[model samples]
Target: MHIENADLNLLKALDVLLEERHVSRAAARFHLSQSAMSRTLTRLRETFGDELLVRTTRGYELTPRARAIRQELEFILPRLRAMVRGGDFDPATSTDAIRVNCTDYAISILGPGLLPHVFERAPNLSLTIEPLSPRTYDEIEHGRVDLALSPVQPPAGLRWQPLFEEDYVGVVAADHPLTADRLTLDEIREFPRVSVVVLPQEQMVIDRRLAELGVAQRSGLRVPYFEAAFTALPGTRLIALVPRRLVEARRADHSVRLVEAPTELAAPFPYGMVWHPRLNSDPAHVWVRSKVGEVAAGLRPGTP
Candidate 1:
């Protein structure tokens, strides 16, 4: 029979059928009905021009041709599988680079910890983080970017894995006059604000929620990064709502303190890794994403 016209799936069925020496047992292995497996066995006999399985007084037995084919498949199948499936991945010696797109605030929170964690395991692999933009998902789809950190829900045909939920906390200078354990919405509006606007009309969820409650802050300054928002708050009554993890991670760099956010504004938002489904099973991708999961888990205890 011509190889091009043959159904290669029968080869696998032949292998199992030869080993089992019973049609029903072989059918069970593949979860196929006995009638369906019998049809497959008939097709196999026609393809090879041999009765691959013959009935004896006691049970079924393999003919000479079937035994010879079985021996050949034992040698060929493993190599064929190896050729189809590539070699295993080893991160310690890998030089592959993974590109990630994320906001500066996300970098401020995850970068310091993620870098060290990745380096400790991979050492040779490189990580490139580009600023998140409207084209971020397009870049990922086209194979330019490997992952993205986002709170925005992804569109269809993409995959997301939640890393952690981050709370919004009020940040002010350590010596600001509005020194209260928790400030009311009216009190927060009284102070000038340092707003972080990474994209056009990109308001944080906290701000949107506040506006829904008829509260708005007076912006004394607008910056592009979360770190800048903290830096602009010192020696002034300017206040900002930023991620609590970001404030705690970079607190030593600036003289800023965290104030408890009001219950209305305390709703936490999820930050997750978004990636194209194409790389969902790639070994190297799977390994690095696990490392990322480890780093994110360390940020907040008991994260799954």
Candidate 2:
């Protein structure tokens, strides 16, 4: 691990040879002669006490030890290159891929606008938005996702940054009677309710607030996604309680009206940007999180 004694150039040459699997091709890639690459491979084998590559019927094969070290090399090589080329990241030229995990509501409210801004700034940077699964903490811990946007707080040992808070609102068809009057829990409960199957914590919060005020309602339907609930409200008497940001983002095109829920039943839900502590000091991760914060700021209350 000591940089002073390590053969950094040999490591690079070995990485290319491992990937190319042919000495001639590896030499071609590094613009070196085949003999030079062969010697480099010999140094690598002696340095590591392993025949990193062996001649095989299929050109070359990596030893088990080499295969084990491949992942480490892949991770470290990039950082090495980045360290050599010191400069601010230009998204337009960077081809980095960022992966984010988020709920359907976040995708609906923020994703549509966020992607374009990112692309405009960093055309070569790609994004992969994964569905926010139930075991969010596990996914983040295991590196299955880079960032997660959720209303729930991140589990212990993870870093959770509060992005913004959203208030609950009732969404009904544009012509629903509740749109004509101030929405109260009594009036909202009078109609069939469309419920989204969310986390147990969310259910407890809703039930606790409603029970405190003695409000009761019958569930008309249950859906897994907020988009489904939003689409289903066009002609039915079903009213859905969803985040105000989600409703506001779609009010222009969707035939839905956003009504303030009863204060007694309304509660502020805090949405956060969460990531593993392992990536706390990573520059790329910091950039991505800052972009997420910028998006959250634009959507915060009174931003309009």
Candidate 3:
């Protein structure tokens, strides 16, 4: 390889070839005829001085050298693609709409600050807030959604930027007796509870912690939003384990008092934003992510 003689376009073809490991399938992926893809594969073999794909008992398999190239390509291709497509984005003049998928909990804490901050800087950009649903992962992977916020770790193949850590606090009616002192895990377990199950296994962290101590959230009310848990707490003995920030924000609005959760149960968990790697170096996306990071930084995770 000399740069001047090499056809840079074949890099993408080679990537698809190594990934698909079958000439016809790789050709289909690149929208080229089978014969054309075969020629491209020949060129790749000649350029690299190796048989990139070898016939196996089952089907085509990547040669060791091809495997090494595939590994490097995965890291290189996305950046190259982003660089080619990320042409001189100006946030103030750009009309890009960024869709964020998150729970109402995220909206309650992050929306108030994030919304205005983004608008102030990127005046022409549109921000769309959508609720996190079962289809969220698929939406983000396919670029239907630009960003997602969650405390749970993102599945592999996505990028995570930790925003803040959230600790759980027990909330009850202002006059509830549990507020008088630090409640034990057993005491907390004895009371009826309002559980926020925003997504499947959203409670796993708290649940796992409690389970280690031989306790569980007492069965009472189950709601889909964190706000619902707050509203459900007043005028009742329902003890809810909610984010400390939620209590700080709405305690005045509701007749609720925050009580110290057991030291063992008050472990703080990380909350953050996740996005696809294709947008890693995209200018407009980078601007939007930076603003989100700024807003998250200002939150300054605090103790109850």
- Best candidate per lDDT, number? 3
Which residue pairs show backbone clashes in model 2?
none
Task: Give Cα-based local distance difference scores for all models.
Answer: 0.80, 0.75, 0.81
What lDDT score goes with residue 164 in model 2?
Answer: 84
User: For model 1, how does the per-residue alpha-carbon lDDT over 1-304 read when each residue is reduced to its tens digit?
Assistant: 7998788878889998999999999999978999999999999999999999999997999999999898677545533543465667777876555778888877777778878867877898767888877788887776678889888767888999999988778888888888787767887778887777765566667777888888866767888777788778889888888888776776475577788888878678888999999778776678878877887887863111
Which is the better candidate, 2 or 3, if ranked by TM-score?
3
In model 2, where do residues sit more than 4 Å from their true spots? 1-88, 177-180, 198-208, 211-217, 300-304
Q: List the residue pairs that clash in candidate 3.
A: none
The digit string of per-residue lDDT tens for model 2 on 1-304 reads 4457668778878878888889999999989999998888887887888998998888799999998777467556545644664545666676555668787888777776677787888787757787777776787786656789887787789899998877777788887766553477777668988877655335534555676787775868877788888888988888888877777777575588777777765558678888988777566666778887888888758211
After superposing candidate 3 on the true structure, give the runs of residues whose Cα lies further than 4 Å from its correct spot: 1-85, 201-204
CA RMSD for every model?
18.4, 6.3, 10.2
Candidate that would win on TM-score: 3
- Tens digit per residue, CA lDDT, model 3, 195-256: 78776755545666787798866779988888888888878889888888887877567488
